[model samples]
Target: MTQRSITVLPGDGIGPSIVAAAIKILDAAGCQFQYDYADAGLSALEKYGELLPQTTLDLIAKNKVALKGPLTTPIGGGFTSINVTLRKHFNLYANLRPVVSFAGTQSRFENIDIITIRENTEGMYSGAGQTRALDNSSAEAMSIITHEGAERISEFAYQLAVKEGRKKVTIVHKANILKSTSGLFLEVAREVALRYPQIETNEMIVDAVCMNLVMYPERFDIIVTTNLFGDIISDLCAGLIGGLGMAPGANIGKEVAIFEAVHGSAPDIAGQNIANPCSVILAAIQLLEHLNMQDQAELIRAAIKKTLAQGKTITQDLSGSASTTEFTDAIIANL
Candidate 1:
């Protein structure tokens, strides 16, 4: 078998620590992969004076697969988002985030499993047009949602649900008010849902869905929504289980896919060596599953679950004394 090559962006702060741990686990599993490092986000801005360097983009284009750690998006910034740039450049239109409550965790909700399929390439996150009002006290920002974008992401969601053996897929929208943009999304979703009769589907407004999620999260199976709603729901589902510390995400398209941890770079705990790496490790497992290495993916997942189940070698967030490396070592040893 030919070893797959992947671009690795251990972005910033705790990003490097987590990626290092994931690499350790990957090596221990004997997974055959060649890695090339790239730079983006704050790290790239500091080293290369460019947030999303062309060199990094070139590498990803050639490799077509990447494993990225959490990247810090500067607030009120001149820099474009590293994630947004990559997604737009590669046409990675589907942002898939799966959230599940693992056993032995102290979560308020149980048996909670939801997959959020987000439109990765467009929406307000696209950095659309903005202008100042005549008063200069008010500003306006545009949010564009096209039928082409809506159709592709919705179809991708339904198809993924079918392949994964999921029976119901929920489409979320805000068409009641943003009747033009979100209405187009709702129209596309309704059009796409007709093809898969075996899989039941429903549409819900974003606000009502949020309320329902908190009240009865188990009712949801697979959720398909626009860029912004999907982003919010995915994070909420993560919090139901634990937090972003354990959430993993993937950006997939026709040609390329990038698996990433769905958390931010915690600069405060950067060198403290206490950040959890399971999210990134699980993201690698996602990458493996994407590559059709299901057996290896299961092995890595089992090792992680077993390590967490041990309950002795957990990071501070999980309420144990183990440092980042120690926790990773535990998982590697178990594997």
Candidate 2:
């Protein structure tokens, strides 16, 4: 395979260490890629006086593929969310978060596998039309969902289901109440569902879906929903398997794709060396799959499974006492 260039964002907190572990495992898996490092989040703010510098954006555009660690976005004030900004900037329409059960974890469920396909750039979660009242008593935000956005995301979901041989695609929404926005989404998604007769389609209200997810998770295969719901549901699915430390997300657009650990920057454990690196490692697997390096992706995945199944040299999050580097070393050794 020809060497590919990938932009690497080390992010903040434990992001740097986990990202380093992921890169080492990738190399061990025999992936031929050149990495171009850039800074974002708090690290960039401290060094460049901005959360996201133009130079970083330029590098991401040039590479068209990025492996990002969890970035810290300051709450309140004038700072916009770096993750949201990147998604909208790149028009990354699909947020693919997949969680699967790994042996030797402390999770209750076993043989769990689910993927949440989130509409990345629209709806209530986009922070569009946000405003505050003069009296400081009330505030409001607008949720705008276009027919094009809904249709495309629905199409993307079914296409992925077909490709992966997934049995069903659940169209999750709350069309009963938020009729205007959610109703439009349901309408368009149902239209898309009719086009894919080979794949089973199930529609459930957002609230009910949440309850069913916890009670009967196996009934779900691929969950497709709007921005806010997807963000919440993906994390819930992660909990079923283990936790956010085991989840991986991929934001994909026509020209560019960014894979990342779908968890927050753990500033509390920034340099403890005990933070779990599986999230970023799984994210690298997604990146490899995106680049069509399936053999290498599966190789790394199998190694991770073996390491976790052995119930040894795993991180604290997975109920083991190994540090991030030790956990990484175990995976590399398995590879």
Which 10 successive residues of model 1 have the least lDDT summed? Answer: 127-136
Indicate the residue-level lDDT of 7 in model 2. Answer: 98
lDDT of 2: 0.93
TM-scores for every predicted model: 0.96, 0.98
State the lDDT at 249 in candidate 2: 95
Question: What Cα-based lDDT does every candidate model obtain?
Answer: 0.87, 0.93
lDDT per residue (tens digit) for residues 181-262 in model 2? 9999999999999999999999999999989999999999999999999999998999998898899999999998999998
- Top model by lDDT, which number? 2
Give candidate 1 misplaced runs (Cα > 4 Å): 128-135
| Per-residue accuracy of model 1 over 6-78 as CA lDDT, tens digit each | 8999988899999989988888898878999999888888998888889999898899999998788786655
RMSD of each candidate? 1.5, 1.1
| lDDT, residue 231, candidate 1 | 88
